[model samples]
Target: MADKNIADKNIKVTIMPLGIEVKATRGEKLINVAYGQGLDVNALCGGKGTCGKCRARVVKGGISEYTENEKKLLSEEEMQQGYVLLCQQEATGDLTIELDGLNNGQKEFVPDKGAYAENITGNDPIVTKTFHQLTFPTVNDQISDLNRIIGDVPGKVALDLRLLSRVPVILRDGEYRVTSAIFNDTIIALEAGNTTSQLYGIAFDIGTTSVAGYLVDLHSCKVLKTAFAANKQRVHGADVISRINYTIENPNGLSEMKELVINTLDEIISKLLAGSGIPPEHIYIITLVGNTVMSHLLLGVNPLGIAFSPFVPVFAESITAAVDFLGLKTLLPAARFILLPNIAGYVGSDTVGVMLATKIYELSGNWLAVDIGTNGEVVLAAENRLLTCSTAAGPAFEGASISQGMRAEPGAIYKVAINDDVDIAVVGDQEPRGICGSGLVDAVSELVRLGVVRKNGRINSPKDCPMELPEKVRNRIKTRGNGLNTFVLVEGKNEVAITQKDISELQLAKGAIRAGVEILLDEAGIAELDGILLAGAFGSHLRPESLKGIGMLPDIDVTRIRPVGNAAGSGAIMALQSKEQLQIACDLPKRTEHIELSLHKKFQRQFVRGMSF
Candidate 1:
């Protein structure tokens, strides 16, 4: 441990754009300080200083000299501009820094609507409210307030001691008329007057990169509002393994991760309540679904075990607890929190949510569902069997790890079409800042189709281009400073191009996903798929033709491919609206079979074959 005198000294750091000031101990890593203060600093390599995504400019500061990683990753111009890697620098004195890239107030594109199965029926929510008009206690009939309120309620009614203490006051406040909020057999809350119509619940799909929330009316089973926000835990890393490593390396990492996600959920809840004009107390239940690691981190459980061989999680079953200690400021004191079950260490409740939303188990024909993200989860339902697997596709699809790649936000190139010349469509119709997942796929698909990029994932040199290729398109292929060929999509001051390295990254990502799909199909004895369902925000926005063109997905009729918008989130909403759906979600883990790709001998062979376009 460090000396007490040295540890006592403090340094001040002010972050720009947000103008947030924070205090840190002297000699602390700048990235740790920023993340501890709830700032979203991008650390794709988990502070190993390899990815160079956490670049920050120091307006004025006394800091440690850069490490070898920083020297290698930062350009001379950037170093001259006083830009330093937050992961590599330690604060020695007061500092003022400015963040860059997506965290710098970029507008993210979040899917607000999802496709819900038509078979889901009923409004029997897990939490319901019933108004009670009790008779006034007299000398002839002197009954206790708690007993009188739950006298006619069926089953073994249980109430918290704290809530039981307020029984008399609540009963007398409305002249013996009150509303009881029942969660199963427990009376979770009691209001002075009739609040039967105010019953509400919130469902959340907590992902590695983003969090999506839905507010639903329990009485009518209609979604009143939906909101989305970046998962604040992204400041630590982009993938589950990076986050798991953080938890292992840091003493308080698990709690910090839990707090960051809870804060994200609170922000989404605030937005949902504000948009719908709903009271916080009206939301009596909160249902959440996420991957196994995310679920472990949210509950302050150590997720290090989930990142290794013979992977084991602390708990794989559903959990129900009160939200009082969850740090959700916008929720009621009596609100209950429910976490859906996980199918495996990698195949989490999000996949279970996908299964629930698509009703894949009931489908008679062979169907494949893929939720694409940093980690791709594939599910196949066929021949009265359900199988799932996870592939580490990396953040290439989300636009990290690739040169000049970014999220699907404003100024991001999202669509590309190449004919005689390149035709690109950017998000927000603004100047292209960088390429996102869809645009990356589309661009590479077009290049492969046009013979600019070969099946082996190599970009053809300008002199070796096809004779029939247009001059404008051929001229766009140029060598960059790294001596590698790049295909320029937008030419200007902020030139957006796809380098040979970018193509390789895309190939690795798409290849892993394709390999997972193939393995699942083979395991289930599926000869052909009747339909393919793309789930999640990234998956939904991806064009079917481009996905197939790049060989990421199987070659099938385009009409059979469907985009199921945020299906995981839709399943969470289904659980929030109906108790039966919640039961189904909890039971899904048992029925589904998980295939561990790491132990599979055929994975490597399939992966190598899938890498080719």
Candidate 2:
């Protein structure tokens, strides 16, 4: 070793990754030095070395001090490779170090509302079946009707029994030419000659736990029909995290979930295609958006690494694949496939789809877009900077958990209003069968509004709150050793009850959303926001005033609050119509900045605080 005096001298260091170059006088702590250099090495445990995400690889000069905590978190191989805990190692001389991918990793999607309308069609791609005249068959050369049809179309064509049996009569009454109507590639109706009719297009929002599809005319984007159904992945796990965990735990769980979702999608595709009278192969294009997990599952990709430490997603850019590649038949073999761009591992393409549709990203004022579903993805941006994070908000609102909770399906309590006397107004204007997510929000909001629940989210009304032997609801509430109360949201005479386990689930969910927003704001150094835009079917129907009254929304200008419906689907549709939009989706990953919330203490503290009523 050289003279001790020289070793202890203040070391001038530069960290280039953050565009930060700062001097750390000798004896300064490593973490402080890193922070001073504008390098965000998250120390969730206040630099106690509890979390290991802040590992740094010393590229040049050695560190003077290395603590045991560094050794505990780093492998011998990594330690030998010059990796040091940024919180534990201090610079002794001129130094260059390799920071984690956080600084150089792919950027996230900034909220862009204007880009959402890029290339959406105004009409549906499906056409309703109708008839036209064809010349009656004559014996003059009496070519077979099948041969004539094969001759008209360039490609080899097959006939369904439904169409085959009608051919004789159709040819006998009409001429050689015919108008054919095909349902999902299966001929459903056949008449005479070329008839131009308005076509329809179907847009689908394939959520992880839920799937909603809309039927629209190809000529005009007017929505003609809509349908919703469960995601079918619940049988494997309720949330993405749990499902990922299950996949990690089981050998074939991931593949099973993937197959299940694809099958479900195929069935829906067939039903919708048939209902709209469009041949599956004839569908010119389909636009879809969902969370990373859902999209991964839909594409049959392994998602095991996304749930673990040093969290990373397999893909962040938008994807385009053949509908047939997904094992789902479509109307157009040549129809374009579009998937929305994802911001990060947690903030998915659905968020992009929503943001694209809302044009919130393009607004001049700073805006926040929160998609509150299985994952509470929050996007905040102003000027040129954008930040995003996702909270693991559970499935309580969607009626996945809770004793009496059900999905926002028929007979599910979707809305609720309570008076001082506790008289309730149920959705569908009928006796409440079970509460859906909206109803749950209404229940919690009403409870807070009526002083039945504390600001901290603790239930205050044990006697007045509907408890006791509904036998159905009571049996569902799960009990723990601590005696913390949970109520069932749904019960069935023959099915498992949605129990109180769901309430804790909801709290966790909402808390995560709150935490993600707080963490993003903290990272961006923003103390106040100009506006918050809720994007989704759920967000559109929610009462923002009540959401705020219950402390779910941040205090902001209420006038700024707005809803941009189905932004994700809209984004996908835009991509379907324009190559420019597709390029934007591809370029988005490079401009986004992802702030890891779990690495920061502020996120945890804020999450805990936001867990209240």
Candidate 3:
């Protein structure tokens, strides 16, 4: 009884910027408390104190002392400014906490458009509306209302009882004239007369780092509006394995993760509707494509199996469920939610989407398509074969796991070049706060080209730098308090730099991706001579020259490397627009061969070789 009371005892915690107050247990962690009240605290390491991303300021309360990880990760000035790691600190009393832009729901930058062959071969959408004017039934010639509506419809029509209940009212309301929304021979909705022109649908690409939504007018097969937001599941971790482990370790982790992503989709759907002045009921279907883990999480399926050896997902087949079952706020209840199929434990539907959008299966020549993100998925089409593998590239590219890394937002450095001196391009033209993924790639690419970083991923000291190297560039190399060498990008009161550990993280990421590419090439027993397609928001932003300079990509002419913007999202849009495309998406998993890099014999040696510049 005493233990129960102690566990139930609560204290107040005030979150700033929103000024929201919530009650927490007496000794609870502030990150947990904030997240419990629906606040998005940036804990990329799943509150394990490894990522050092959940840093918050304590404005009005005394908290627990820092741990060893905190001492190593936080700067001296940050500690002096009343900042503490939220995951490591316990709330000893009432507290007021302030979150930074990364945690305060700041808008993230995602590529709004992609380069896919916009030739939608067919306009036959999955859901279709047909206007019907039925003859009124009398005592002399009477027929059942359900039979009368579905008599002319082809195939075995599955009837929803709830929709059936409204049939009489709709038939009478329109005076025997009505429109029926049909999906896969299922009568999902019944509306008033001549409402076929209001048909619409939404397609979503649910990436581990971000979610992109496209609202399409099914009538004209045109995309009306698009929306993007950072994935809410990022608070748990930046990779799928971390998120899966989170679900295993916590009691309510699965449900919580599902709710977070659903919330992200809801926000995006609201934006799409508001921006286009479309009614929620007008949307008849929603199509989604994501990695296997993301697909599992969205459907409330436990992804524990996919996180371990002999990884096996509960289901890799396409799934179709109602929108209401998934807890979407602004979408209509009867709308069909379709999730495309997955190929393997790691090689998921997003890869399939990439193939669908780029039509890699039908390409005559050998081609390679790589979707760059925290979890990089690579596809190679050569010798009449399609091969794919997923690489654990980590969060280095998305600006996680680096000491001074952040998302591509305002004040983030997104581009860099080193000639006489280092020059950087910051997002929003603001001061350089930290380096993002593209900036990290650009900086390291320039360093490798200039001999500042060696082939073995070592940073040359100022004295050891080549005699021809410019002095201004050499002077930027310095050692920080952690005793690791760092290359300074912006020198100031709050200096932005990339440390030795950051380089190592990037090496591991790029090495994994390159290794995957090599393994696929070797498996096909072919030498690469064709073009490469970079597919994703991250891939769209990266420079092809920089990618090759860093040894992340193969040695190919810059013109051969092309950026297909958000091809996975484009695949989803294609599926939403045409039933033929959706069927192709469903059948892609069966056709393409998946190469499990973990079980491959040459992964370790190839990884080591690929790590070098």
Task: Report backbone clashes per prediction.
Answer: 0, 71, 0
lDDT of 3 by residue, 409-499 (tens): 7777999989999999998898787888999999999999998898988888887778889999999999767676789999988789988
Q: Which residue runs does candidate 3 get wrong by more than 4 Å?
A: 1-25, 33-40, 75-81, 98-121, 154-156, 481-484
lDDT by residue for model 2 (1-613), tens: 4787665786766664544556777766666776554343434333555345456777778786557777776778988888777766766677877675422311211111211232465322323333444334468857787666545543444455535666877765556556654333434345555543544445667776556665555555555555555566654445787667666777887777777776666666666766666655345456677888888887878887688766778987777654556665444443445666677777787777666666655767677888777677788886767677777776665555554555454345665565523333454464455566767776677656755555666653255445432333223344444576543333345232223444466677777888888788777777888888887767766677667765667888667777666677666665444456655655665666777777877877898878877
Candidate 2 wrongly placed segments (more than 4 Å): 1-201, 215-224, 249-252, 330-334, 427-430, 461-505
Candidate 3 lDDT (Cα, whole model)? 0.86
Worst 10 residues of 1 by lDDT: 105-114
Q: State the lDDT at 229 in candidate 2.
A: 52
Candidates in order, TM-scores: namely: 0.93, 0.62, 0.94
Q: How close is candidate 3 to the true structure, as a TM-score?
A: 0.94
Worst 10 residues of 3 by lDDT: 105-114
Instruction: Kindly list the per-residue Cα lDDT of model 1 for residues 346-432, writing each as its tens digit.
Output: 988899999999989899899999999898999999988989999999989877788888777777898999998999998788878
What lDDT is reached at residue 396 by model 2? 64
